[model samples]
Target: MKKFKKLFAATVISLAMLVAAGCGDQPTNEDQGDADNGGGDEVVTETPGDVGDAEITLEFWNGFTGPDGEDIAKIIAEFNNLHEGEIAIRTQTMPWDNFYDQYRTVVTAGEAPDIAIMHLDSIAGYARYDLLTPLDDLAADIGLEDDDFIPEVWDAGVYEGHRYGIPLDVHPLTLFYNVDLLEAAGYSEPPTTYDELVEMSLAVQEATDGDAWGIAMPVFWPSNMIFYSSLMSHGGDSVSEDGLTPLYNTEIGYEALQKMVDLVYEHEVSPSDVQADGEVTLFRQGNSAFHINGIWMIAGFEQQDGLNFAAAPVPTFGDQEAVWAGSHNFVLPKQNDEDPERLEASMKFIQFVSENSLQWAKAGQVPATYSVLESDEFKALEHQYNASQQNFVFPPSTPFYGDAWGPTGPAVDEAMLGQLTPQEALERAAREGEENARDAAEN
Candidate 1:
């Protein structure tokens, strides 16, 4: 039942301290291109209230433009109906591409919304800019103690020892296999070990006569996550414990990247130069037998016309088990005019959302609350349950964690595309990360 201690002021420290202190990675929230709703939309209630007609209208904003966005809208509707006229929330939903730009512009213009959704990784940058408010008081008021949320997720929202956000859900990378395809390949279950995964991939390739791939590998966002996951599984890390040195280019890193390269070239189970969308399409079209993607794909995949699929945890590929994960969090924007009532209402909304997070789970996320995760309802979600309870790994808690990917991402992309060797890619990424760390340390 630990509480977040308030910071006297926003702290700005070197990236080394940020990393050493355990700040998480920068999540790449992709645009699913579901709708182009760019402006604020108000959600109205249907039922009567328990808080009477002492009404409070709050503005909420989020970048949930995927299938998850629909779920969020539905949750907002339900919350409104339950609260009735007492609390009305006006919501603005948009794609992730411009979400931060619009949020920062509004906050800078002194028209900040009462509350907004944010990625845990981006909290440090926002807090550094003094664009977010510390939520320690509101968290306490709503009884959101440390034990209420997953430790990794809870700590991710803290920057320089001040809590700035409340996590809603964690999206982790998971394995999705086409049931029919697996059976066709003479396998009753998805691969549980790295060797087993490779064997299955090879079998699928042979069975399909090279017409179908054993797996799909994206060269962009998914690539970075998979590489990091692999690195972690090998008992290696991206940066040193002190956060001053890049470690991914070491022998262990080479091993991890080599494994990825082997999947494409050495084993010939994956397609080369496949973009993210192409990889997803291959899986959806039944051309790929297995896919490693975020849990967010569950809702969409379940709706595909004739695809029969099952989910599993990302297998233990190396000495350790690990999978890359990120979270969506609720944050309060910095405001020129502070209204205690509005803040209180916002906290209540967050608490209500946490309590009813099963609805959010319906959008293919791992609930942040242990209570929800341990529920029979959540356990019924096969993929999410396993991923949440298994070796889910978050990026190192650091402001520089996100920026480190700038170089590492490209290096991995090159290796996947066969433009560089695995060792070359790891070495390059390490050099780039070291330069980034050096710059941050000096400044």
Candidate 2:
């Protein structure tokens, strides 16, 4: 242990020297990114540090404040202790609802953590502000290849052909249905067809004879009403081909939403009382027939028993299939002064996390790095959902995504409350979403 401490101290010194050397050259926008992409240039080399020679601390923050947070904290503690004390990683948990505001304030004040897990959408501002380090150079040094990741999930790091974030995992919305409920109701398989799905729901309600609904999710959030989860299979997108107009005004989009309403108000198969935590709790307790949520809900699902459920890709309302997806990724937020040692260390940490991500995948996130996903252990995970998680889809992930969805969510909520007719609600939501997208584009 004493020797380990000595080596740790050496590594820290080496890292500091590397940082000092790194201060010399920071690449321009045109020079940095993955070569797998045609747009990036090589990053200059810096001095190497001995792992046991130095002492440096890094602050880390994330929004897993729920049960998932507890597990992540445990993983970090192990990482910190495993090192020779050369790398000291500290963690902070922020509530998901307000994390962005907190993150923005700190970063603007030049007091941001050495590393952080950020949403894929908000990084556009960070990139635009020139606040992050390019990971391509570091990736090349460590044999980190772009081909090692799911192209769709991996490309998330690239903005304007330059990569900013190192993706950790993707959490996509999936269909979580109660096993016993389906079995007892005389349904052996999940419905692949919409009409079959509705029929199965009615059967469950009739066979079980209770408040259990066919399906449930908050119907409000005008933009959410048109969320990507239910429409991906149909190749339906809420944005026009140019991404400058709202496409939800089309017959396809309205038809999709009308089906949702039918399941609720029309068929009376899905109860209205299930909202927010209520829906999750009911499903967790085996009180509901079906739930539409992301892989993150796996922990909560595990807490319940006699409650076998399976995850399937979202069904197609038209002729195709799709689902909503989000990624947890690492980015080097702008530093008051860029240091090479810190940058290299940050990259190393990211690589280490990616290599050891199986611990994370068990909690329900899809591995963003390909190595883990194709690893023997990952394949052996006892998860029934893995079979269907391969094809998660989200809307065009761009900086404008937040504005498009956030501002229009309230309009959707109002519509769910019956404050507007479908046409009126869709028109209003479309207008607001478009306006928000436009505002972001102009910036």
Candidate 3:
């Protein structure tokens, strides 16, 4: 152990000296063009650091404050212990609601952490504002090739032509069913079709004598994601090919949304006006036999005593199969005073996390890497592996996605509450999307 520590120390010192020597050529902010992208032709040379030589400490910020946060913290602790004097990570956990605001404020003030975990959909926005470093070269050095990851997840890191993020895991919305309830309803398996889902839901209600409903409808924020996924399952898309206009106003979209409304109002198998958390809570309390939520809820549900739940891909509501999904990515915040050593350390940590992502999968996220997903260890994870292989529909690449996403829940809620017809609700949602697009284009 002493010999290993000495060698690791030597490696750290050698790399530090090399970086110090190269710093003389790094450009000052005044002369730096597009400073946010690590301006100037600063060359970086990577030297593999020996284990147990963690001398450099990198700050990391993430919004994983739930049960997953403990898993992430444990992983980081392992990384620190393994690298000892070569690399150390200092992490700050925060609630996701305030994370972006804090990140933006710090980034604008040049106080950004060396690394941050961000949602894949939000990458384009930060990249557009030059707030993140393009990882093409660094990624190559870390051996993060496209072959290692799912094509869709790997491609999600790209903005325009440059890659800005490295995906960590995928969390897709899937169907969660109460196993006992399904059996009581005479369903040997979960529903595979919309009609089957409705029928089973109705049966569940009848079997329980109104003690529990079929499903709890989500009517808040990302409830739109479910609606959009349903629309796409029917061969409908919410955005135009150019991503500058909304296409959910079409007849196909209306039919898709109408199906959701009928589940609540017509079939009466689902409760309307329930918020996102309320849906999960209802399912947890055994008030609903089926729930549509992200894979992240798996760990929590597994802990619910007597819940007897299982997960499956969201049923095919239309001619195609699609489900709302998103990925978490590790990104380096663009820094004007870029240091090669710190950058290299950051990438090394990310690579370490990616390589040992089975620990992450245990937290209920689908590993972003194909090999990890196919591993015996991951395959044992049950529903996540199957759900990850399904057709996942992500938000279109756009800097203004948040703006457009905001209007969908209200519109979906309106339709579910009978305040407007499915057609009118879709039209309102489309108008909001178009207005957001116009604003984004103008700005």
**For this target, which candidate reaches the highest lDDT against the unseen true structure?**
1
Native-to-model Cα distance after best TM-score fit, residue 91 in candidate 2, in Å: 1.3
Better of 1 and 3 by lDDT: 1
lDDT of 3 by residue, 9-73 (tens): 00000000012111111111111101211222222222222335457878888766666766887
Q: lDDT-based ranking, best first? A: 1, 3, 2
Q: What is the lDDT of candidate 2?
A: 0.58
TM-score of each: 0.87, 0.81, 0.86
Clashes of each: 4, 30, 8
Candidate 1 C-alpha error for residue 93, in Å: 1.0
- Highest TM-score against the true fold, candidate: 1
TM-score of 3: 0.86
**How much is the lDDT of residue 178 in candidate 1?**
89
> Model 2 off-target regions past 4 Å?
1-54, 220-226, 240-244, 387-390, 395-397
Candidate 1 regions off by >4 Å? 1-54, 240-245, 437-443
Q: Count clashing pairs, candidate 2.
A: 30
